[model samples]
Target: MNYPLIVFRGLNLLVVLLCASLALGAGKPLTDFSLEELMAMEVTTQAKTPQRLSQTPAAVFVITADDIRRSGAVTIPDVLRMVPGMHVAHIDGNKWAVSARGFNGRFANKLLVLIDGRSVYTPTFSGVYWDIQDTLMEDIERIEVIRGPGGSLWGANAVNGIVNIITKSARDTQGGLATARAGNLERGSGALRYGGKTGDNFYWRGFVKYFDRTRHHGLPGETAEGDWDSLRGGFRSDWYPAAGEQFTLQGEAHQTRAGALRTEPLFTAPFARLNDEPTETDGGFLLARRSWETDDSTRYRLQAYVDHFQRRRNLLDEDERRTTLDLDFQHEFAPNALLDITWGLGYRVSRDAIDSGQVITYRPSKKTDHLLSAFAQAELPLVAERLTLYAGAKAEHFESVGLEVQPSLRLLWTPSTRHSLWLSASRAVRTPSRTEEDALIVLSVRPFDPPLPLTSAGNTNIATEKVTAFELGYRGLLNDRVSLDLATFFNFYDDLRNFEGVPAAFVLPPPLPPLDALFTTRNSETKARSHGLEAALSWQAHERLRLMGAYSYILLHVEPRLGEEDFDFSEEKTPRHQASLRAWLDLPHNLELNTWLRYVDALERGPVPSYLELDTKLAWAVRDNLSFALVGRNLLDSRHQEFPVESFLKNSVTEVRRQIFAEAIWKF
Candidate 1:
């Protein structure tokens, strides 16, 4: 299969079916719900209060549970691809590069991800390891995605966007459920969940899930060496002691093992060779939260969590162990009718122990770091429902860097009940990570006469990366059945991380070998800027039919100072243009059909050809509690490459092949 031919054929068939249905049928559709029902959806990720989607000031997107189920998505990252401004790419079978607007790479550092308020980003690399980010898809309530800077609320690394995964409460899932799926690429997967009442006022739920994934196709259609598997289990408990107070506790554990083929440099003869290595990872976390409301309309919440993470990998000859503890509190009050205020405080501490080898080594074998933050925000209704202003700032102290403050100002104007306009300006920062501050990596070991070694050393004086962003947005409901959201933003970045080489040669004792100079981390004097626009539209054409479309455009420019090396790959790695369209149809007899079409522009660095992707899912409910589905993904092409070749550690590129899967779901 290839582009245009297969894509046009599929689209033609879909158009004919849709037109015939609309011209022949005369009943209600699945989208019979009113537009007010859609706007009334509440999201809490934006601020302290759960506000309607239309009232938020930021460029926010909500992925509902129905969207997840209908899309036939197996993972969180896969589901995120539906968002308008997000950039999600598969690097390998077990790795993903996900960001927003621009700045995408294997280690995308500017995006922050959280699960039930627990940060999943690694401080060592300032990125997320997607393989272990697993959850029961059916248990997810919704995913809130903010496409612009959220540093004033979420702190560091939230420079680009924020993704918050919120799960259903135990009280809402008081039943038993099971799912089993199998496919050529997915291999096999299964999950079991059970929820019930633990006491008169306490509800609890537990779940266990496991999956195995096969390898991808190489450049020449050969099977690549990328296979992975994992096992995970978790539980949650919710207690309601009174009408105005609630308590919740949750914990999860996961173990994952994976393998990949890599070509690594050697110190002796045969400088490089292809080899396969096994990677092992495991982690666990426990969290607790309490919330209460007073008679005076004041709300308070306290949350705490502890996490333990360990990764043993042969690819880098590295073993890492980390433990973290976090505590946070928030208070919201309405002192007056026109003023709403929120204050929050947080503290986090992490300790890491790394076992290094010839590949990379940390200067300090063990280290501990602390981060403390305080933030407050106020919302004032300038003219009641017509105009409003929001102002907030956060001050944070890190062990490596002193006090840093992030601030934001936003204004919202409601011209009518059906339309809203919002504008915002914000400042955010990305703090230095462990890799940039205290790591030594051996790029290559040459087996020459003197056994010379090339190594890169981390710099302790590396400065933080900062960004100032301005955004504008418009949201409107054209009629009872149509709605649209549009947003634009410009971001200016300074003090970005760059590499500078220092020429030096040092001779060691007779027992050791000599080393040559290599590049080190530094702050660039130049600056970078990016501007983009995102638009999304939805239409409920019929009672049983709905259509959604999204488009995004981004332009990035970087200026390197005089006499400095212009070496930034972010602009080339991210796509400049992307678009997607989806359709959801509810047929007779408990049958549902969903289709998605997406396009991504070519990468500047890879010079990879642009591609179109098509996906479809057909599902039937045999009974009220039992269902089955058949899903097809990447149907437009037999295979396509989504990421460029990575030669740093010799991680090659693999093509994603066409996949079909069958799933069975049961609920009681």
Candidate 2:
């Protein structure tokens, strides 16, 4: 890739577009809110309580609905690129590797994700299945992202960060909406939605969506085999039975079919072969929540959810089914003028059944796991509006892990309304996943003279990975038109997962040769530390033009315990530097143009070179209820590889290609 040439062209194009957009006549401002309103936005993910962005004592970022509309992003992962210090990469058309700070891969386990207060993080893999986590983009109200530990409030697995996707309520979406989209890459996609009110206090909404994406191009003349398609439908109902009280019930179901070219290892003559097979996934979840506020300003909430999913993969000959039930309750109240308290209790149970395959098997084919947790946090007004302190801790218990405690302390100094500084220290943990405890996987088979088969066996005694993090942050309205947020953090990790070599036992079967090499998972004395800095700036350059920029830098170090060897490539998995700039312009006659340019540093381990990319969107509002758009993505390069093939799956390497799409949205 010609980095200089690509960057120069990208800048030139940006300038040309900006000049053209400015030359046109200006209409009404496209933004409904001013920059001040944006700066004062409220976020709930950081502390699980609504607070102004400037007052949140954490590294937080919110992706507003308007931001998403102008981003030209068709997927949730793509929209996350705007967040500083976040890494989003595509392994194929249907798979994404998303992480915060570092340690990024197919199954990056350090981050926690939630959808409308429901936990979407899978205990089976300790990561999110990005492929099937989807919804109507237009229905999302906002995405609140906390770029640090949330374990003190959210419990276990909130090691590095948390992402909470909040959708608009049925009352807010009352009406009818339809959208259709098509492109060379997207192929075809559409959505239909309707909302109504049964009475003054009750509202309901339902929606259905479907999309199909064509396969990506491979290394030269080849075509990657990861075409994807999905159909999903869901409904939401909200009832305000009385003042200061509300009830919400929602559910969704989805069916997905995706293809992958995987390398399958065998014990026979042909040790390995490329297998192109389709994977089928079906899943659904039902969630209910009730919240009420008392006359004295006390608030209480109770929520429950049930989730079930099944996956079948022909390449691996694997079939798995899992179901989870969770219930939670929380209360918030201020006992005095100087103190406020929030606490919660939660319980979850998960059951899973797995069918063995040729390359993978589990010691226990069926199992159940239980989790019990309680957390509390106190907010103290040490110096009234100038200085405040927050302290919290959570205690969680699992049958295998016994008891675990996570704690956090934070201090916020506002000094003034426009500028605020904060500091935090927190401890978080990533519990062992089912795969690390019971599964046996055949890693590779080298058809040597004796057919050496390398296998990895799970250990039941593996310990949870732990991290202690310290963070300092500042948020300031540099001026009326510009706002800036800066954050830095240092993290120390202990008892990280590692692979230890085991003495191989020779096995000679009639149809296969002798097997020799073996390894086992362990929470070895492996330790690591990381430090990073992130900065974001937003400038309302003009009434019709808005610009945003972000940059991030990270460095990680890892070492093995004394007399022990470590093979984990924790430090080289993520890029050390990343930056992005975006511009949104509203032009004459209800026309809008938006562009995003970004650069990502190379990954030492993926051996993937650095790359620069650009995405642009142009839309025209034909009427108050209808609009059309043309979007171009990856315009800077024809195609580029964002990540390497995953080790476990050995999925085919697919490059992201330039794509152009057209969309139409109508509201009634």
What TM-score do all the candidates reach, one by one? Answer: 0.96, 0.96
lDDT of 2 by residue, 1-668 (tens): 78888778867866775676567646568886777797689998877777899899999999999999999898999999999999998888888889998878878898899999999898877999888899999999999988989999999898989999999999999899999999999899999999999968999999999999987777555558779999999999999999989999999999999887888888777888877778899999999999999966599999999999998983365788999999999999998878989999999999999887767777788999999999999999899899999999999999878999999999999999999999999999989888888877777877887677777777889889999999999998989999999999999999888777454554533223446655555554688899999999988777788888999999988866643434333576789999999988898888998989999999876578888988999999999999999999999788898987666777777888899999999999
Per-residue alpha-carbon lDDT of candidate 1 for residues 213-330, written as tens digits (9 for 90 to 100): 9877887644376688999999999999988888999999999987766666566677556657667889899999999998666999999999998988734667999999999999
Query: All candidates' lDDT scores?
Result: 0.84, 0.87
Candidate 1 least-lDDT 10 residues:
508-517
Model 2 residue runs over 4 Å out of place are 5-27, 220-223, 448-450, 506-517, 562-569
